[model samples]
Target chain A: MNAMLDAAWAVFVRELRLALRRPAEATQPLVFYCVLALLFPLGLAAQDVGLRAFAPAIVWVSALLAALLGIERLFRADVDDGTLEQWLLADVPFPMLVGAKLAAQWLLIAAPLIVAAPLIALALNLQPQAIGVLLLGLLFGTPVLVFSGGFAAALTVGAPRAGLLIPILVLPMMCPALIFGAGAVRAAQVGLSVEGPLYFLAAMMVLSLTLLPWAAAGALRNALE
Target chain B: MSGLSKRQKRMAAVLVLVLGVGGAAFLGFTAFSKNMMYFYTPSDLLAGAAKEGATLQLGGLVEKGSLRREDGLKIVFVMADCEKQMPVRYEGILPDLFREGQGVVATGKLGIDPVTGERTFVASQILAKHDENYMPPQVAASLKTADGKHSCAPFKSLGRPAENLAGKPMTAAAEAPRS
Candidate 1:
């Protein structure tokens, strides 16, 4: 167990190091998130009331797309460097390594978006309670987004135009997270109980966390072969 | 011979794929179906399709000359999809963009008049669209006619009249009858 954890830690650090080295890649999704969020008010010519009404949906969609932006490369670098083959041969559990990679992706890519969500929510005129719910929703939802996206990324690691394929494959699976995430904020805005949607989002995260890494490891093995 | 035949391995792989995909789809669909409460048009209400007293969304344009104000912040208006109309009662400060002939979505329960048996939407929250150029996509989709055209064509094609209504005092008691 200790060895498995150490291997996973090493993989996590290596992935983070690669991500930090390419500063543009790390920051591109955050920039995309901000730009798309700001564009809603401009495109709608909406009043403050209107902006507030749609803020939850807009923020959720932007987060979904932004998380998607970096997903295609999740397994590509490791596969290209033949590290995937080495991991397959290693004594440490393969799924733990994949989980570490996904954890790193979520930390580096989705965490910033969750942190910056309040600023964008404020710009969209969301209520304080609603903004809080948005933050919680993102905290729970982004991991599911990363896991589902990572699965798609792994599945298409050997395929051509993986960047395009990842979104097409992952977006449909992302519907539950988007709905629950946005729904929680909307519920809070309208003085309804947000617990229902928040619980649902939490369930989705748990489900994805339990299932995705193993599926991704299986896909990576297929790609390596 | 191998520990497990290639055919057995292939069958096991297919079984896992089916179960995983099927289970995910089942869970997703069940959740979606449970939460898929959609906006009902006035016609749908009139058709008796909407459940009585269940909280749901009603989307349409506020009818001209149907808005009224009662004592203690109570406001009443008629929401129309051009073909059918339903009365809505709300007791709150409406969004600034709310006006006659403009699109709005009201979230509430369906109630029937005790005497007249008229279906009324008792709104808990009212959401008006942002501007003249924008309409909620759900409202737009619901308002589409049989010919794939908007049933609320006058509001869209006759842009001047819609703009004129925007300037009207949406919450003013003036010209608003007591109910």
Candidate 2:
């Protein structure tokens, strides 16, 4: 148990270290999210009320797109360098390592977006109460996005033009997360109970966190073969 | 290093997967049972699904001819789920697609009507929900009564004249001045 944890921790640290070396790539998704948030108000030319009404959807969509932005490179880089097969052969469990790597990547990508979400929400004129739900929703929803996206990325790791394939494959799977995450914000905005959607999002996160990593590891093995 | 065989490792993964999914399913199902109705129908509202002053969504078709324009922007209409009907009071510019005998979802709190002492939904926002099978009101009216007379039709005569805002450009924001 200790060895499995230690191996997973090592993989997690390695992912973070590798990401730190490419600062621009690491920050691109967050930059995309912020810029997308900025474009909505200008594009709509809407009044405060109209803007507020559209705020939840705009932020949630931006978060979804931004998460997509960072997903394609998830497994492709390791597959390209041939490190993925070596990790598979290691004594520590492959799924644990995959989970750790996904966790690190999620921390690098989704965590910053969660931090920046309030600023985007504020800019989009979201209510303070709804902003809280937006944050909470993002906290639960983004992990589902990352995990499912990582699984999609794994499926197409060594395939040609996998970038386009990733989104096409992953976006449909991501619809529930988008719905529940945005629904929670919309419900909170309208003073309706957010528990239903929020709990659904939490359940989705749990399912993805458990199931996708194992599936992703299997896909990685397939890619190597 | 705590050495484990490959089969044991796979077993542990399966166990974790099963346990995790089981736990999540439990939570999701419980939440679904608790809040299966995302929006309350008029029948659900009448059955005491929500308390007075509690915020919720009321979904139904706007009863034809039951719409009456009151002082200022206030409009009173009956929202019927084809089974039961509830009176709704809203003060704002309605959505463009908001018309009589169409699906509309109103979000607001339930309150006691001062005059009637009956429960009324005081809506803060109104969203018109329409599907691709767009039918003229006459077509819809005929189709609705095809399966025998709908009890909801009695309130049709009680409706006062509603201002036809078609072709007039209106702001999406109710209180926003026309620019």
Candidate 3:
């Protein structure tokens, strides 16, 4: 068990190091998220009330797109360097290694988005309670998004034009997360019980956590073959 | 055969796949259907399809000559989707773009009139087309005729009355003194 954990840790560190080396790649999505969030107010010319009403949808959609911007490269670097096949051959389990890599990707790509969420929410004129719920929704929803995107990324690692394929394959699967995430904020805005959508988002996170890494590992093996 | 039969291993994998995918789909579908709403026309509401007090969006053209101000900041108007009309009551200032014959979407609950028991939409928010060239997509789609042509029938019969300028009609464009 210790050996498996150590191996997972090693993979996590290695992936994080690689990401840190490419500062531009790591920061591009965050920049995209901020720019997109700012564009809504200017483009729509919405009043404070209208901005408040649509803030949840704006934030959630921008986050989803920003996450997508980085996900196509999740497995590409490892696959190109042949590190993926080495991991498969190592004594540590493949799924554990995959899970570790996904964790690192989530931290790099989605965690900052969560931290910056308040600024975006405030800029869009969201209420304090609604901002809290929006944060919670992102807390649960972003992981599911990363996992789903990672699975799709793993599947297409060996395919040509993976950049084009990833969004087409992943966007449909992401609809439920988007709906529930935005719905939670809207519910809180209207003083409705946010637990319903938040619970659904939590359930999605659980489902993704259990299933995606194994599926991604299987896809990696297929790609390596 | 090996310790575990190959067929048995395949069966186990298939079982897990089915349970996982099926369960997730079931949960996702139920949550989505429960929360997502399609914009309903007045005819749909009039047919009693919408349950009383259920929160949803209603889309139509604002009926001409039907807008009336009851009290300070309380306005009532009839909305028609060409086939039928429903009365809507809203409190607070309407959007600048809100006007007769323009497309609008009112989000609120369908309430029963206390005395008449007729269904009326009590709007919590009134959203009109943002500009002259832009129409809310749902409102535009709701107004499309069966033959795929855009129909302005809802506004055609209700002739364009004199522009209501600050709650009064301006008799002629030239009558106003140059600013």
Candidate 4:
């Protein structure tokens, strides 16, 4: 357990450092989120009805995109710089290493989306109660996003067109999270209980936790080969 | 003709092998059409849908009122090109922007009904709304001007502003999940 915690912690630090090193690029998703937010009001003619109607989806989608944007770096950069090779050669077990990296990515990417959610929710004029649910749903959904992203990054670590291919392959798989995340929040906006959506997101997180990390490690090893 | 030295013969043979292999592979890929996604216009797909396990890409606009959930998980929608429609079944959640009248690209396999063997496809991936502005990294080469300035790649195609757009970096390109 100690060794596992240590490896997970190490992955977390390395992932954080990587993001902080290029704060501009690291913040690019937030930037994308901001830009996309601005687009809806401009494109949709800025009516409150349209904005409120689409708010949950817009927020979750942007957040999902933000999380996805940084994921390719998860394995690509490590592979390119030989850190992944070293990690594979290291004393730590591969699954722990993979889980650790995913945990780190969720912290850096999803955590920000959660923090930024309220402000975006306000901008979109989402209901106050809905904003709370949106934030919570994202909290659960983002982890799954990170887990799935790790899987994609590991799978296409070295291909020339991996950058493009990864998104095509991974986005479809992530639709579940996007759906539940948005739906829960949307449900709350109408005074409905968001329990189902939140539970669904939580279920996705658990399912991903059980299956995705091993898949990611297997892919990473394949990438290393 | 003069007889070639051993080294010259070896180099010539290597050159021949390269040309031969390259030619054969190129022919094989193209003849097989293995690399490009199999594209079916909405009408073509509806007319002769194939059996299951055959993957295809169908591009069209989402049909109005057809974007609803049957079990909150299974999404049934229709893709149209104004003149034709292909029924689409997606078993998971959909992209946020999936809506009526938006252009979409769906990827999945064909399924034939047991009773009639009539074919329909199951799309797992759906790209909603065709956008006007796209500047891929590779497009950078083509986007270059005589002055080395980047060409204006606008998002207007996707229903956005034409001006003040950065090559926009898609900055969102990396947002797809890794697995």
Find the candidate with the highest lDDT and give its number: 2
Q: Which ten residues in a row have the lowest lDDT in candidate 2 chain A?
A: A187-196
TM-score (0 to 1) of chain B, per candidate?
0.54, 0.66, 0.53, 0.47
Tell me what TM-score chain A of model 3 achieves: 0.96
lDDT of each: 0.77, 0.79, 0.76, 0.67
Q: DockQ for candidate 2, please give it.
A: 0.27
Q: Considering TM-score, which of the candidate structures 3 and 4 is the better prediction for this target?
A: 3
Give per-residue CA lDDT, model 2, range B38-81, as digits (tens): 56777767776566766787887787789999899999998886
Compared with the true structure, the alpha-carbon lDDT of candidate 1 equals 0.77
Candidate 3 lDDT over A70-135, as tens digits, reads 687778878888899898887666887999999998899999999999999989988888888999
Model 2, residue B32: C-alpha shift (Å): 0.4
Q: What is the lDDT of residue A95 in candidate 1?
A: 79
Scored by TM-score, the top model is 2
By DockQ, highest first, what's the ranking? 2, 3, 1, 4
Q: CAPRI band of model 1?
A: incorrect
lDDT of 4 by residue, B36-93 (tens): 1234556545554333464556776676567768776887777664345667788776
- Residue-wise C-alpha lDDT for candidate 1, range B1-179, written one tens digit per residue: 22445576466546655665566555554444333334667765776654575567888778777898888888888987645788988998888878766678899988975545777899999998544344667766665432222125322211123444433432332222212
TM-score of 3: 0.62
| DockQ per candidate | 0.04, 0.27, 0.06, 0.01
Local error of candidate 3 at residue B75 (angstroms)? 16
Query: What digit string (tens of lDDT, one per residue) describes model 4 on residues A188-210?
Result: 77543456457656666766765
